[model samples]
Target: MLSLIYARSLDYCIGKAGQVPWHLPDEFAHFKRTTRHHVVIMGRRTYEDHDTLLPDRVNIVVTTALAYRAAEGVLLAHSFEEALALARGADREIFVVGGVRLFERSFPLAQRVYETVVHTTVPDGDTFVPRFDFSGFRQEILERHPTDSRHAFSFEVSSYERVE
Candidate 1:
């Protein structure tokens, strides 16, 4: 199964100028726990912004540049379809880790969405996870944490499963 995992603010903002808008250790830890053993597909920008490949997962980068080459152990694809094809037959869920473009294209292809919704907003954010209509999916709140010194905003880890 392909699951799109991400964190977004209440305004649907996911990034600001190529970086996550805030520092939230708890959310980062949650993301690590959820996607550690899975395949992660990201766009070229996301791959570049991360600087290093996430440890313990097969990292797949979708890029259109012919001359693009990533670090060792990272697979590169020219399209979202190709990325998914490369991940085919994996026993575990493949996570569509993002940049806005990747998520926009892969959202329809995902069976599940694991989203952490922050209780704040980023007015200057240029990146976003597209607004979704949750009618076709059953939503569940998996985890919720209040704001603390380490976590600026309260957030909820919500999962949406496509209703069969």
Candidate 2:
């Protein structure tokens, strides 16, 4: 199955430019534990921003550039289809993590979404999660937490499963 995973602020902003503000240690831990042997697909920009490829998982970086060299532990693809093809026979879930463009391109193929909704607004942002019509999915709020006074924010961990 394919899943889309992200942590977004209350205003629905996933990132300012290309950075996610909240430090999601719990979320990362969950991802690492659950998808240890799975494939994780992301945009080239996301890979660049992260600077290093993740170990113990197949890192697929998607880009449209004619030519580029992949870093260690990264497999490069020019499109979402190509990325999926590379992981076609994998037995574990394929997770699509972001940068917005990659998210949009991969959303339709997602069978589920694991989202951490931060309960605060970020006044300035250049990136967003695409609006999705949830008619075909079932949503469950898994957990919620209030931000410490220093950060002045709160958030919920929600999961969405496709109805079919």
Candidate 3:
């Protein structure tokens, strides 16, 4: 099935200066645990931002630049369609975890969405998560994390499944 995952602030900010601005360890761990062993598709910047290929999953990096080079194990798809084509070969959930454009493009095709809402506003955000219409989906709260020393912002994880 096709899915997408992302965390955004109250103002819908996902990235600031090319990186996620929050330091929520629990949310990060939840992301890792959820997407593990599944196919993850991301934009070139998102893939490159990571130090290495995401272990234990098929990684497809979508890039408009035809000449772009990624790590040996990482597959490159020149278009979003190509990326989805490559991800379909795997019999696991295809998660688009990415920069803004990828999320916007994949929103319509997603059967599910794992969204983390961080209860804080990002004043200097450069990237924002695209607004999505959730009327067709049912939301279930998966988990909620309170603010603590390790995490500066309180957050809640919710799973939205399209109601057929």
Candidate 4:
């Protein structure tokens, strides 16, 4: 099963253009630590924005076209199915990360979601979180931290698991 992880502002917005404003070191560290040996899937745009091959993780980039060449430590797939195929033998959980179009396409296949809700809004955002109907899922508040000197807003780390 697929899993998603992302952070959204209070207004449910994830990015303004193609970037997240806040520093999410803690979140990144947690992800790296937990999914070090897993395959992480993301859209071409998300891969371009980050531009680095993460150590100890398999980076899979999904695109509609095969024009782009895969980097030394990265793999390219023309579709989600192909990406999953490339990750078939991996024994770790597959983590689907951002770029809204990718999230929309992959959400239904996701068994769980880890989200950080930032208690603030970006009035001029162009990207947003998917509207999830959580009727069949159980949500747990994993952690809540008040924003202080490092960030302008407080946020909560939450985990959602599908009941069925």
Alpha-carbon local distance difference test for all models: 0.89, 0.79, 0.91, 0.81
Point to the candidate with the largest TM-score. 3
Global CA lDDT computed for model 3: 0.91
- Per-residue alpha-carbon lDDT of model 1 for 122-143, expressed as tens digits? 9999998999777899999998
Cα RMSD for candidates in order: 1.2, 2.1, 1.0, 1.6
Question: Candidate 3 clashing pairs?
Answer: none
Question: Order of all candidates by lDDT, from best down to worst?
Answer: 3, 1, 4, 2
Question: 2 or 4: which has the higher TM-score?
Answer: 4
Encode model 2's per-residue lDDT on 1-164: one tens digit a residue: 99988877777788776677666666556657666788998888778777687888988888898687778768888988888888776666799988787788878888899887877778897678887666799999987776665445667887899896
**TM-scores for all predictions:** 0.95, 0.88, 0.96, 0.91
Task: For candidate 4, list the clashing residue pairs, or say none.
Answer: none
Off by over 4 Å in 4: none
Q: 7-126, model 4: which lDDT tens digit per residue?
A: 888788987666775676666566676567888988887887778887788899988876887578898888888887887656668988877877888788889988888888889988
Model 2 regions more than 4 Å off: 149-152
Q: What value does the lDDT take at residue 149 in candidate 4?
A: 77
